[model samples]
Target: MSKTCLIVDDSSVIRKVSRHILESLGFEVTDAENGQEGLEKCDENMTDLILLDWNMPVMNGIEFIKALRARSDGSSPKVVFCTTENDVEHIREAMSAGADEYVMKPFDHETLQIKLKLIGFD
Candidate 1:
């Protein structure tokens, strides 16, 4: 079966763009508007990978990741933070919070592919 991916971002544009890129890469993509919705999706069916955003209405990426990692099946999905937070502190924070990889905002298809490759997903 094809691999599954969940994208959690507040921006519709980002979600649309990411969905297209991930679909092109052969990942069955599902998207949520925020962390809470993402968690709901996860509870229904654990995805193989998650592309997360740092900021959102309900919950943020860090909060979602921590909650996800707390679950028994949480460690199964590779979490990648896709956000505008490019500073060293944010990057370190994300890694510490259980993100497998990081991608800056406004990423292109090639950049996403590279990030996924780094996580052995591409």
Candidate 2:
């Protein structure tokens, strides 16, 4: 079966671009406009991987990760923080929040592919 991926971001353009890239990579892609919606989606149908953005209106990526990790289902999906927050401290904080990897915003196909490969998705 094709792996499922959820792309969570406040930006519609980012979600669309990520959906296109993930679809090209053979992922069954879904999207959410913010972390709260993303969490709801995840609860409804667990995804194999999550490409999460750091900032949003209702809830943020770090908050989402914390809640996700606390689920009783023990569904440990690979989470890659896809955001513009490139500071070292923020990267460390994301890692500490259970992100499996990090990708800066404006990432290309190659950069995303590398991150997917690192997470054993490619």
Candidate 3:
């Protein structure tokens, strides 16, 4: 079966762009407007991978990762922090929160694909 991916970001444009890229790479893509919605969707149907954004109106990516890792279902999906936060501290924070990889914003298909491959997605 094809792998599933969840794109969590407040920006509609980012979600749309990520959905297109992930779909092109053969992923069954789903989207959420914020971390809360992302968590809700994950509870309903766990994804193989999650592309998360840092800043949002509701819960942030780090918060979501922490909550997801705390789940008892063993649903540890590969999480990639896709955000504009490129500082070292933020990256370390994300890793500490259970993110498998990181990707900066305004990424092209190649960069995203590289991250996916690094996380064993393709």
Which model scores highest in TM-score? 1
Candidate 3 clash pair list: none
Encode model 1's per-residue lDDT on 6-117: one tens digit a residue. Answer: 9999999999999999999999999999999999999999999999999999899999999999999999999999989889999999999999999998999999999999
lDDT of 2 by residue, 31-120 (tens): 999989998998899999999999999999999998998897525799999889889999999999899999999998899999999989
TM-score for all predictions? Answer: 0.98, 0.97, 0.97
How far does residue 98 in candidate 3 sit from its true spot (Å)?
0.4
| Candidate 3 structure quality by residue, lDDT tens digits, 24-119 | 999999999999999999989999999999998889888889999999852579999998888999999999889999999999999999998997
Clashing pairs in 2: none
Clash count list over all predictions: 0, 0, 0
Between candidates 1 and 3, the one scoring higher on TM-score is 1
Q: How many residue pairs of model 2 clash at the backbone? A: 0
Error of 3 at 82 (Å): 0.7
Q: Each candidate: RMSD to true structure?
A: 0.6, 0.9, 0.9
Clashing residue pairs in candidate 1, if any?
Answer: none
Worst 10-residue lDDT window for candidate 1 reads 113-122
lDDT of all the models against the reference? Answer: 0.95, 0.92, 0.92
Candidate 1 is scored at a TM of 0.98
State the local distance difference test value for candidate 1.
0.95
Model 1, which residues run further than 4 Å from truth?
Answer: none
